[model samples]
Every structure is written in C-alpha cells, then in structure tokens.
Target chain A: MAETIEMDDRTIAIGKNHKLFDVERIRADFPILHQRIHGKPLAYLDNAATSQKPKVVIDAISHYYQAQNANIHRGVYYLSEVATQAYEQARECVRSFLNAASTEEIIFTRGATEGINLVAHSYGRRFIQQGDEVIITTMDHHSNIVPWQILCEEKGAQLRVVPIDDHGELMMDEYASLLSAKTKLVAFGHISNSLGTINPIEKIIQMAHQVGAVVVVDGAQAAPHTPIDVQALDVDFYAFSGHKVFGPTGIGALYGKEKWLDAMPPYQGGGDMIKSVTLEKTIYNDLPYKFEAGTPHISGGIAMAKALDYVGQIGYPQIEAYENDLLNCATEALQKVDGLRIVGTAQHKASVVSFVLESVHPHDVGTILDREGIAIRTGHHCTQPVMDRFHIPATSRASFAFYNTKEEIDRLVEALHKVVRMFQ
Target chain B: MDTDLRDLYQEIILDHNKNPKNFHKLDPASHSAEGYNPLCGDKINVYLQVEDGKIVDIGFEGSGCAISKASASVMTTIVKNKTVEEVKALFEKFKGLVTGKVEPDMLELGKLAVFAGVRDYPSRAKCATLSWHTVMAALNSKEEQAIVSTE
Candidate 1:
C-alpha cells in the first residue's frame, strides 16, 4: 500500500513495496559492505565515485583469467577460439544493455574520458572547422568540457556554454539561443554528478538535431541509475564507465550510431584494428575494432557484461523507486539540521545529496564523518564550474547505491549532528 | 576517537582559525606568492616584507578548511621579525612534524606543537604545509609572481 509521509512541511508518497524491494538481499550480494571502518559499521555512501562489485561480477573476472586466457581474433588454437567467442559475446551483451541496433555500434574504451577523446579526435578533425561552434552546458563534467575545449582550440571553433538556473536546471531558452546552423557538436552529461540533476536528454537531442549538430552524452552517472536505449534517444554517441556500474575499472562502452561510426576515421591503429598492413599502405578493420587499439582489457570486458546482467536482474523500476524514496528521506532529514543548506534542489533529481554547513567547511565535515565510518565524497566532484556557480568552495556529497539502507542514512544524519555540535 | 579528533582540532587551533592573525594583504609587501591545493580547492597567499636579512612584516590572505587556515594564520604570527635563516629552519622543523619525521616537542614548537596530530591524516599534511611553501616561494622569488600547487 502507498503511504504518505509528512516530512515537516512537505508530504512524500512512497510507492508500495519500495520498502519491500528486498534491499538486504541486494546488500548480501556485495561482499565489501559487511565490514568495519574506524571502529564502526562501514557506511559506503560514495557510490558515485565507484560502486561496490557484486560477487557474480567478481567471480566472472577470476573465471575469465583462470580458464579462458588467450589472445582474441588473431589466434586459431582452441583456447584462442574460446577467448575470442567470450569477448565477442561480451560485446553483444553490452549492445543489448544499451539496446543498440547492432554490436558494431559499441566500442570498448578505457573509460568515458577516452570515449570522449576518441570522438573529439576523429569526428572533430573531419567535421569541425574555423568559426564553428561547439555547445556544452555549465553542468558538464570536466571530462565532457575539456575534450570539446581541446577540439575547439584545434579547429579554431568557438565553444559556447548553456547556463543553468538557480534551481540547477538548464535554461532551455539559452540553449536554444546557442544553437544555430554553425553549431557542429553539442556535448553534455546525461546527469550532473555534483547536483544530481537529470537533464531532458530526449529534448536536448531533438534540439541539437534541428541545428544538424551531433549530440554526445557522458552517461557515466546515468547508466547505473536508469535504463538507457540508444535507439530510443537517437543520441549520436553515448559513453559510460564500467567501474561506476558495479564493474571493473579501466573498461567502458561507447555507443555510436552506425552511420556516425562508419563515417568517423579510426581513433588509433594497432595489431587488431587492421585489415592488412603493408609497407606502403594500411587499411583499418571493421566498425568497433577500428576504435579499439592495442591489447584491450579482456577480463574487464567480460566482467562488465556480468555487472550489467546483475543490474538487469534487479530491474531499473525497482531501483529507481527505492532510491527516490531514500533521496527524499535524506533531503528532508538534512533540511531539519540547523544552519545546513543543500546545494541542488532540482525539480527532478537522482539519489545524490550535496550539502554544506554554515560554519563548518566540507573538508572538516568529511573528516569528522570519516571517524564515524561514513564515507561521503568531499570537494568539487570534478565539477569546479558547478561549485563556482553555487559560490561555494566545496560540498560534502552522500551518493547512494541500491544496497544502501535507510538506517545508514540515519547514521549519517546522527554523525552530521555530532559534527555540527563539535564545530559549534 | 573523540580524543584523537580533539588532538587535531585543539582549542588553540580553533581560536587561530576563528580569529586569524595577520589575515590580510601587506599593502607594500616586498614579495608575495600564492599556494593552491587542487584536491580540495584550498587556496592561500603569503606576503612578506624583508629588510636586510630579517623579515620586517608578514601576512596572509585566503579561504580554506580549519587546518589550512589556522596553519597559515599561526605561521604569519610566528615568522614575523625572525631572520630568514631561522624561518627556513622552522619550515623544515614544521614539515618534519607534520610528516612524522620529527617528534613534536613542546620546547621546539611551543604553540605550533598542536599540529603533530596531522601525521595521522596523510592527506591533510599538504593542507597544513601549503602556506609555508608559498612563504618560501615569496622569499626566493626575484621579480616574477610566485605560485605553488599541492597536487
């Protein structure tokens, strides 16, 4: 049954079975959660930094290295064929995860950063020219901003920014004004890591298409929280990191539309990304292989696919409803604290809570919370422009995962009260 | 755990953070340098006026956490009117204390000894040492503006 919670002046209605999501069962899947840090139960609230790996995903890595360890695509031996099949199957798994039209659309990257750099190098070099404009939002992460900046510098193009309102929402009118015939690319984050604001990416993609500008989305934060469909969004490029989705680091996926992937030049040349190499001429390989140069993170790819499977089993609907309830509870509880102010109050937000105390610095608050074994991220969160817009040096952010419980948040709130008292 | 935290955020350290000494720019300073901790966005600027071999005036201006601000504030008060050689020695001693290389002694550091708790937080040691590095840069800079970063 749905229940209405009177949280001070606001009333929040939690959906039925939000509490019945069987979170304890999900928590048990992650082995690292049951531990002590600084003489207290560990409260891992830094999920946005990186999520804890489930046992299935961890086992996948060991299994890959233990049994199927061989070179892919080039080897003809029995072990080599097995390894090659596993790797290609992992690609198919990723293609299904993002609902891409084909596996050729997915490119294995070191992470989201490399994925962006690949686009900037290949697409920008061929398309962008002098006096062209590349648009980005103020809420873009450094990864999204810097690559476009470097590309604009190389092409002598102008880099335009879409400003955000006081509520941390993008000013759509300003974005409309920034778009024109000369706009070559529009790159932005699917969700703000610092503010937890979920941008209207479907509308953004539609708007960019009007100006003939390709849209590139940094989905590092969005992939773990919500379901994604490349075909549905019609996004030219979508990139996400594996480590943030309860998988291994040094591995990620970039989904590009087939036409765009075919049109762009090869990012790097190496052993696997070649049809045949002669002394005078060299031809590049097929769609995904052209972008993946050198020996890729083999085990990481298989394990990342396993991670996606794990999230798929729990389902996004359940994850979203339960996490939204947690976000509301934490926001209301934090608001009740004296002299505390939340940084972002977007109309539609994710599970991240960024806040600052009136008298205490965020770094100080982080240290105090650490003593209580509550790990929250403290700083600009690699979004310095967001910090500058808010006129604060830093903020203490508590980002939740599916495994986090309401009791852990209570522990965080209690520790924050102690921090306030200590500073006072 | 409370006692451990108290050691780091002692009453004297808290006082210095609240009402920092020489927490302003020196209008006609002879030298100045800025220090930045990129990891946490803590920034500090140290200004100095040197006459002969001694420091005639010292001051600082910045915004940071309690540890960084108090370290800069106390540094200005202690370094003024001291010879350049003595200031350099104190910087060495202070670095040693924060890095756990030298034992914190009441006789050696006097009021500055409270910072001995920094050794436990390796990440915070840079916060306490940022201002000192800036001051040294200010002293050594000939004409160009000096800047340092604790990455």
Candidate 2:
C-alpha cells in the first residue's frame, strides 16, 4: 500500500535565516516572476485569486501534448497506452495528495465551481427533500452560495446562513443553535478567501455528522495553504481548484466519500460514462468515471499532479512555518501604515491580509499599487455578504505564496505610503 | 511624477474628486436615475432639474473612483442650460473623445478632455462613461429608482 520515498539532498537541505525556507529557489521555479512591471520588479501578492505556475507544471503540460497526445482509456495503440497510464497515474496522484481512500473517490471537474455544482445538482436533487434545511456560511464565495440557492429553490428547501462576528470568525455558538434534525446538508468554506480566516472545519464536520448532515467543504482557498487529509476529516465531499494550487486551469478534483459517490447519480451523461447503452435503456459506469463524462482535460489533469508534487516536495512542515512568519511580517507592517485598518483580525489566519485606508477607495489604491508593480486584489472578492457584514464597499487584499519574501512586503509598504501621500 | 499617473489623475480630476461640483440631490428633481458598475461596486445617481426640455440644473449623489467622480462633476458643469437634444449630442461627443475616436476640442469640451487618456486603459473606460449613461437613463424616465449597469 506504500511506496518508498527517497529523501534526497533537495529534501533535506536546511537554510539559516529568520525564514529557514528556501524562498529564492522557490521563486526561481516560477517563470512569470522574472519579468518587470511598470519598470519595477513584480511583487505578485494575488495568490488567492490564482497562483502563477511553476516551470515544472508548465513543462509537464507541454510534454503531455507533445509526446503523449492521444485519447485515454479505450485506445489500444502505444501512444494511447502511454496516455492512459499518465491519466490514471494522475488519478492515483490525486488520491495520494488528498490521502483519499481510493482513486474511485477522485473525480476531475473543470474547477471548484464545477465540482460544487456537480454535488448540488446531483446530491441535492436526490438526498435533499422538500422542507429539508441546507446550512451555509455568510462568508462563502458567490460560487458556493448561488448553486445552493438554485438547489434549494428547486428542492423546496430552506437555506440557512451561519453568521460571522466582527473579527470575521464564524459564530460557532450561533452555528450550533442553527443545526437541528431538519438540516440534511451543511456546506461551508474551509477558509474565507476574502478575510483569509482559517475556519474550524474538523469541528464543524464532526458536529454535522452527529446530526446526520453530510458536509461539503469549499477548499479552494485552503488547498494551496494547508495540507488536506480527507480520511482524517471524514468530510463527505471536498472541492478545490487547480489554478489556485500552482496548477493549470480548467481542471480540478472533487473528493467524495465512496458511499456518497455510489449513492449520488451521474451529473452529466455522455460517452465513456456508460457500462451498457441499448436502444431501450442505459447503464452508467462505476464510481469516478460516471461523474466525469466524455473527453476530459487530460493534460491539465497530469499537470495538476505535477503542481501538487512540487508543493509536496517542499513539505507542509516547512511551508506552514514559512507562511506563518510571512503573515506576521506583513500584518505588523500593514498595521503601521497611517489610516490603515486591517479588516479580519481572527486569531487564526493564513497569508491573506485585507485592509482599508481612510478616504481612499480600493480602486484608487489598486491603481496606485499597479503603478508600483504590486499586484493585489481590490474588490468584494466575490464575497459580497462579507463586505456587507463589515459595512465597507471593498478592501485591498494582499495574499502571499511560498515564493513571497519580506523584501516584497517592504515594497508593498513603500507603495502604500505613496498612495497615502497621493490621496493627501 | 509618472507621465501615465499625471494623465490619469490630473490636477483638475483630483480637485473634482475631492470637492465634486453639483454633488447633491435635487429635492424636486424632474428626472433621476442611478448607475451601478457591479465590477467594482461603483454607484452614481444622476439628478436633473429640466424645465421645458432644458436642463436648468443637474447634480449627482453617489460614490465611485476619482475618474468616475471627476467625469460626473465635469458633465454637470458642461451640460447645464443645454436642451435635452443638445445634452444627448454632447454625450456622444464625450464618449467618442474618451474612446479615442474623436480628438480633444478644449474650446468646446473644456475640462472633459482630461478623460481622453481613459482610452489607453480599457477597464477605466467604463469609469469615464458610467455617470453619462445614468444621465441618459434619467432623461428617458422609465422609473424613479431606475438603475443601469456598466457590465
């Protein structure tokens, strides 16, 4: 059940500094970071939206298209054999990446949005009956919110929103009060993309299970930052995006518990998803392939494996240690900026820092920062309810990746000073 | 100063953004409409006091970026005392100027030419046109609380 993992010099090398992580080498792997923007070196802090791909992942994609370009699963020729092996191997890669029980539980979709939609349409149509309750959080992305709304309307179910406190932490006491025997499903984000607040997902999952409600996690923001173990969490379904995890776009994975996968009907019906199709009736394929219909994103699937492996090589023990320091560094620096107020002050947070400056609109701040070659997201971040909760139109958010350095944080602060002076 | 920055945030634009002209509601406004850009959540409400088809007074009440605020401020200053037809014509010319289809005529447009630089930045083009569109919607009074989107 286990393969030998070789610990090479690359894995064992330890650096000396406030940051023991090798950020320089990590930054070198990403090609896009080499260029200059507006005559200034780029400080890419928009990690939450999407991460820049490393050269290895890019190369893997190109290699697949160039060397092994063939339809997988049914082909008998050499190229097809290689393609099938590559594709199936990637499935195993995903299984190992998430520590999922089996490859049958891993289904590839376009992105997290598609993954969640598949669950809502297929599972919600079956298990969620009339008068059933579906609970979600107020801080969820519109992608997570809208699908459930459509499902609830279709199923004649009620959608309850769990509120968040002033510090952007989910109101756990309020959440406990909301749950009851009527709640058939509970969907929540593992981390708030806008606020970067790490939620108590395990505790939430345990509570949901006690009431017989299946938990679906929106792990789009957490996949890149934290290590995921589906077996340990025992979450019914976990969805994540490829583009956010240093992988190619148009590809992502949804990990569903095998029992739930078997219980839920196929989301889409087409070729390669049928065991038998007569003139009279059709029998759907088994487990994962039933959900994944027709020609999938073959190259993207393989590239996602490469991206996961890239991060795995760095290891979470080292990555988390580095990110915590980076978060602290950025937070302290941002707090010192005049008229600046950090929005989410949760006790536990990731590398995202959201803030607003008095009398300065986020658009103006974004424009000024862009001139300085600093890329930060400026808007409601597709979390409109969260914006309403804070009573601000939008915020300037800077999200960090492993490649980000203290030097870049310094550049952001200097650029922010220019913004304040410009507004003054 | 960066040349592009100066072009984008001209002194006149900044001045208008800070203290926008005619930035208030008309109590008994004949025509009014709200404009919203969902992309950045920018909202602008244009209020017009038209007397016998002539825009006797015009004002706006809302919040947006400096470009949008300045564009609305400049619009009110130029279109006052103009007829409905003339205001519509001026809108067409202003749109053409900012989109780089027409050259700036400072003698005619006054400070509105400051927005001509918006053509270089396509995303900012919507910012330049949001308030103008709101006024057009207000003139053709379909609803009192009418809102149009710059999608």
lDDT tens digits by residue: candidate 2, B27-137 = 888889999988777899989989999999998988888888989998999899999999898888888878887776766776788887788767788889999999998
CA-based DockQ, model 2: 0.66
* Model 1 chain B weakest 10-residue run by lDDT: B102-111
Q: Give the per-residue lDDT of model 1 (tens digit) for A280-359.
A: 99999998898888888999999999999999998888889878988999999999887899988999998999999987
Give the poorly placed runs of model 1, Cα more than 4 Å off.
A1-19, B104-106
Q: Candidate 1, residue A95: CA error in Å?
A: 0.7
lDDT of 1 by residue, B58-127 (tens): 8899889999999998898889999999999999999999989877565878667889988988888998
Residue A318, model 1, lDDT:
81
Q: Rate residue A237 of model 2 by lDDT.
A: 95
lDDT of 2 by residue, A167-223 (tens): 999999999998999999999999999999999999999999999999999999999
Best by DockQ: 1
Alpha-carbon error at A97 in model 1, in Å? Answer: 1.0
What residue runs in model 2 are displaced by over 4 Å at the alpha carbon? A1-20
Each candidate: RMSD to true structure?
Answer: 3.0, 3.9
